[model samples]
Target: MTTHYLLNKLRQENPLVHSITNQVVSNDVANSLLAIGASPMMAMAPEEMEEVTKFAKAVVLNIGTLTTEILEAMLIVGKAANKKGVPVILDPVGVGATQFRQEAVSMLLKEVTIQLITGNAGEMAYLAGIDWSSKGVDAGEGKASGREIAERVARRYQTVAAVSGKEDFVSDGRMTIGILNGDPMLTRVTGTGCMLSGICGAYLAVGGKPVLESTVEACTAYGVAAEIAVENKEVNGPGSFRASLIDALYNLSEQTIRDKENIKRYHVNKSEEGTNE
Candidate 1:
């Protein structure tokens, strides 16, 4: 299915997305999901996690503010989602910052059959086991390009992976796509990546196409919305831009996505490298 069609399906279906995410971005994540016509259920209580996962069409797990209790809850939700065949999107935020975060991510990957993984370059690089300089939640510097990191992560985990940066890259082991439509202002805001992960859940829940295609569409749609948000003259800074971004997501049109989308496809070599064409 086309990206536009998938987006329409999401609005029409209004799937339930159970997001067990960090406290820092829970509100924004829910708002972003709502803006995209998805029902967001930010249920973190361990008692309700399995029940919520059963009802959810998708589950998003974010390790932004990792804690032992949160990790346990994520595992419960993720396992339940897997059993129910609900798509699960994982965002390993600031994973390289601490051994605890790394261990948490490792445990999640081992226990859950993740449908898609979304994060910045550093996070993806850490998952891909590449050498990258990480500073907290930031992407930091990496020798491997975002496309390479995304592809490696996908192959390593046997799942689709999306790396967000100046340009966003999505891969499902074999093919990788790049989206260049976002603005620098996105970095200035908190929870933008977290919100994008929630949006990814929405798209995956719609599920008309392959997981890779859905993920690529999600990243493209988000970047396009960012571009639209930044174009508003009233958006003078991150604060205004954040508000405008929600508005953009709420008003995002298929026509706008088609017009503004800057996507490029790359073929992945079996040698675990991506060649842009």
Candidate 2:
């Protein structure tokens, strides 16, 4: 799937995305949305979350830096999105890292009708009820691939799932897509996953079979931006990489995503264990 078309569409439409994200990358999320031509509203106050959801085309829920109040707000907005039929994208930031985190993620899932769940390998495995390891607030040690777990959870929940690692995987129970165009440096900086989830929400807002296509395009768009940002050696550190990433996003063009996208996709093999099938 080519990202060029979707990127252009998102830019032209400038969808409004309401985010109930962690404090760690709220600023980065907002900036990434702006760079990609989407308008973002970071509304945490429970009093206004429902109202905010009413206006947004889609909603993103992240648990990187969760608070009781933030969780409460998420419930409000998530329900509102469901009632309005807007997509709800969930980012299980660190599900297996702590009991509290796991419980919170579980609670949220039980309450909301999630349209998508994006996370790393460890988080995806744990959420799928498989044993996994994690390092405080970070993806833990695990042999279960994110792609494998994403497909399972997505199928079970009847929702779209994206598991990001060296190769990112996106699935909606039937089709499974693998995107391989990101720079490893993305992991060094915080909130890239969060930003990707927000971007996915933006794509969901646009509507169509295009939702999955939009997600694949967004991932490629981000990877291409990372590739472009790392082209210069002098700016190698996180600080430089951060700015360069934003600049890359800001200057991203349709041709660039289409030209640089390194995505491979196929159907799952039903007989294979722990495989997308």
Candidate 3:
């Protein structure tokens, strides 16, 4: 029941998403949106991005694999998205890995107002201007709590921030949520994080009170799909995990989110711990 409530809203709306993403997962990102009932538009041409973003519900910028041209497109699109009051999601993939990537993300931030920022602990810490020990694209093996990282970034960016780890933590600098229904196998796949950002774009299009709740709903749906995928994998590896994950998203029902949903959230000012807190 929970799945249909959100999915139906998204499908019925057929929100258009503008993405300036990495080449590595651009196709996968586009496919994920279609599976979840959203329309995807890949607009990377620097000249057309501004025009394309004007009509989109939201814009997503990712730096998984960077290029100067793509960076230019991102800034242009971001500015247009901001001008139209459309939501923007920034995903800094492997942000701490190099000066080039960090500089690129910094440039975009200076030019546009991002609505939601989602990344692993390491990427988020780096974007928040903290020196987090990281290895490549994956989040640092260190035990930096997702909640701590998300809160710091959200407050710093003045936007909703999400840090995904064993358990995902989402906050808008004031309210926080911890989602714990995903499986470790989710980490074995590529583009899952990227897809989550795209999912967020879809929810943002639906327009909820405060917008942050729309983001939380998207993350909950992604986590629930991961859990269901793991159950259906039956001891399979990442390949099977990927297929099952898509199936779970396509088959998600409202009853599952209402009954089996494991998402927990609370206002930050309340001084709570965990989702219930």
Candidate 4:
């Protein structure tokens, strides 16, 4: 299926997304999902995790502000979603900053079957067991390229991995697709990456394409929205850009995605590991 076809299906289905994300960007995450025609349920109570997972078409687990209670809720919700055959998307925010965060990610990966993982280059590098210099939540300098990290992470976790940066790359242990569509202003806004994770969950919930295609679609759509948001003359800075971004998502069209998306496909061969763009 085509990327626009999956996007149109997501809008038509309006799937429910259960997000166990940090408090800092919960509002943005919810609003972004709603803007893309998905119902967002920011429910974190461990007591009701199973029930909420039962009703959710997709689950997003973000570890931006990690806590014991929040971690517990994520585990419960992730496992429940797994049992129901629902897609689970993980955003390991600031994972390399602390040992606790690293351990938390390891635990979650051990117990939960994540369908897709969305994070910056540094985060994906850490998950792939590569040596990367991470500065808090930002994607610090890394020796390995984003494509390498994404492919390694996908192979290690047995799922789709997406690394977002100036250019976005999504891999499924076989092929990696690079998307060049977003703007630099996206980095100025808080929770933009988190919001993209929520969007990935929504696309996966629609379930018309493979996990890799769904993730690429999510990244492309999000990047296109950011590019459109920054094109408005009214957007001067982060505040205006953030507001305009939501409007862009709300008004996003399949034709726009088709016309503006800049994507390149690369085949990943185990014997000869090199990018063939």
Off by over 4 Å in 3: 1-4, 233-235, 266-277
Best-to-worst lDDT order: 4, 1, 2, 3
Per-prediction TM-score: 0.96, 0.94, 0.92, 0.97
lDDT of each: 0.90, 0.83, 0.82, 0.92
Q: What C-alpha lDDT, on a 0 to 100 scale, does residue 178 get in candidate 3?
A: 85
Give the true-structure RMSD of model 1.
2.6
Task: State the TM-score for model 3.
Answer: 0.92
Cα error of candidate 4 at position 258, Å: 0.3
Clashing pairs in 3: 1-254, 1-255, 2-254, 3-254
Q: Which stretches of candidate 1 lie above 4 Å from their native place?
A: 273-277
Over 1-277, each residue of candidate 3 has an lDDT whose tens digit, in order, gives 1233666789889999887777888887888888788899987889898679767998989899889998988888888888889999999999889999988888877788998999998999887666678898888855557887888788777788988888888898777888876788878888889989998888888785465677777888888888888888364899888878877887876667666667677567545323221
Q: lDDT score of model 2?
A: 0.83
Q: What digit string (tens of lDDT, one per residue) describes model 2 on residues 228-260? A: 988867676888998888889989998888788
Candidate 4, residue 25: how far the Cα is off, in Å = 0.9
Error of 1 at 77 (Å): 0.9
lDDT, residue 180, model 2:
92
Candidate 2's C-alpha runs over 4 A off are: 271-277
Which prediction has more favorable lDDT, 3 or 4?
4
